[model samples]
Target: MKIPKIDKTILVHLALFAVALIYGANYTIAKEVMPLYISPSATILMRVLGAAILFWILVGKKRLILSNKREKIILLLSAIFGVVVNQLLFFEGLARTTPINAALIMTTTPLLVLMVSAITGGEKFTFFKIIGISLGLLGAAMLIGSKTVSDSSLPFSFVFDFNLGDLLILLNAVSYAIYLVIAKPLLKKYSALSISKWMFTLALPFVLPFGFSDLGTTNFEQIPTEIYVGLGYIVLFTTFLTYLLNAWALKSVSSSVVGIYIYLQPVLATFIAVALDKDSLTPTKLIWAACIFLGVFLVSRK
Candidate 1:
């Protein structure tokens, strides 16, 4: 049967929008399982293994790989940065921080993506955008230096007092930004599913040792079934499905458009967190989130 033809522009936007919604829910869904019931290593392991298996099972022998040495290296790098480093840091960070904080911190990815893209010569940075970068940095500093969840803390004391989880999330953002820059060229040479399949397969080896150790200690019977549902969501929707959509979007849109979709993630994440009583929205979050949002707007605007 022939698939109905959709406009490329609409398809790209739809793909990105779906990813943003998935990621938004993911912040809360993922956090509910960490350090409390699952270790970061275990969670990352599940994500990597699940995604790899699903990609292989669903994609099967229909891959369109060139299999050149250069292509292999790019895929390897993408896997390392995109999955291995990104998942490890994000889960570890989420374990230590609240869902809202993780969501807010991830907004910096677009700004970081812009900077990485500029330095790598894939994109040009303007003077207006330089100012935007400054504001974004200031916003990140404010959010990171402050307490994770409270209104009583002094608001002006952003003296580089680091929160470990928040810092790791920032590093995750950096790794992901680099991944986007690295993966852009590969999309031209291969299909998104092809890149994803190889990326996760390559990442599995690097992540195995840590995840294996964590899995050994995990007592499965103690975990509630709801948590399993959450894990299923994380592995299937957040990790697997979202990455596919993101890759497809990246194929058609500029990185700027791709980055713009991220703006919705924190909004959806925050609302879900608040409604579920998983995380609270504080005055500081509002202030810092505003700074980041405004900065993102300036940087992304043509």
Candidate 2:
């Protein structure tokens, strides 16, 4: 049997777009399922468990090699940040915050990536990029300070107490940025599927404990069919498909190209949320979004 080769250029573009689209709509779809029918930890458990099963099914039979002890440790750490903490924080955050805020706050990841890259001496930050990073932070702070769906009565608490959900999501962004940095070297040694499968498998121990109680409490028979569909979307498209597409794209395109596509996520997320009436566009939000977008453009426009 022969697999026909598509043009790598076109396939790369489609893969990038697919990643953005899956992630963009996920804000609302994931929000709809969590807390209402499933706890955040339970959602993380299902997403990883389901995706892990599918990844193994796709490639589990093949033997994978890790070159050294350091690589193995890095793999474990990657699972912690990338799979366990990253997901646990994101779903919990999304449950408390509006989809718009979650999406908007996520735009800060690229900047975090750059800062970590600079700190690790993987890259240098120019003065202009620093300013852009500052502006982006300003925008994020503004967005966090703005009224959220979860805390309309306590707008100022974001500065003092901090909206737990928004804070968790921001932390999730930082963890993801760190995961990107940690996983880069491993990608050079292994295929993405192999690395992803192992990482998620290792993550199960960490994820299961937090989720077990919630899983036990969930009334599966009472859950609506629509929520199940939303969960399927999260497991299949957001987790599984997006990872494959991203890994495939990285083989052909620069990581910077992949990072640039993140800008689309917030836009699509915002549009979907607004259209669904799950979130509304406000003057402050518009102004802050502009700042963040412009800042991200400046920082990312190498």
Candidate 1 runs further than 4 Å off: 1-5, 148-161
Each candidate's TM vs. the true structure? Answer: 0.93, 0.92
TM-score of model number 2? 0.92
- Model 1, span 1-302: residue lDDT tens: 99999988988888898898999999998888888898989999999999999999978878565668987788889999999999999999999888888888889888999999889888888987888888887887777887544235655323345688888988998999888889988886688898899899999999999899889999999999999999999999999998898888888877667877878989999999999999888776788899889889899878
Task: Give candidate 2 misplaced runs (Cα > 4 Å).
Answer: 1-6, 148-161
In Å, residue 12's CA in model 2 sits off its true spot by 1.8
True-structure lDDT of candidate 2: 0.84
Model number with the top TM-score: 1
Candidate closest to the true structure, highest lDDT: 1
Candidate 2, residues 1-302, lDDT tens digits: the string is 99999997988898899898899999999988989899999999999999899999988678778888998899999999888989999998899988888888888887888887788888888987898889888887877665524456754232333577888888898898888777877776689898888878899899999999999999999899999999999999999898778766766665556666877888999899989988876666777778878878888776
Against the reference, the lDDT scores of all candidates come to 0.87, 0.84
Q: What is the lDDT for 205 in model 1? A: 95
**Clashing residue pairs, backbone N/CA/C < 3 A, model 1:** none
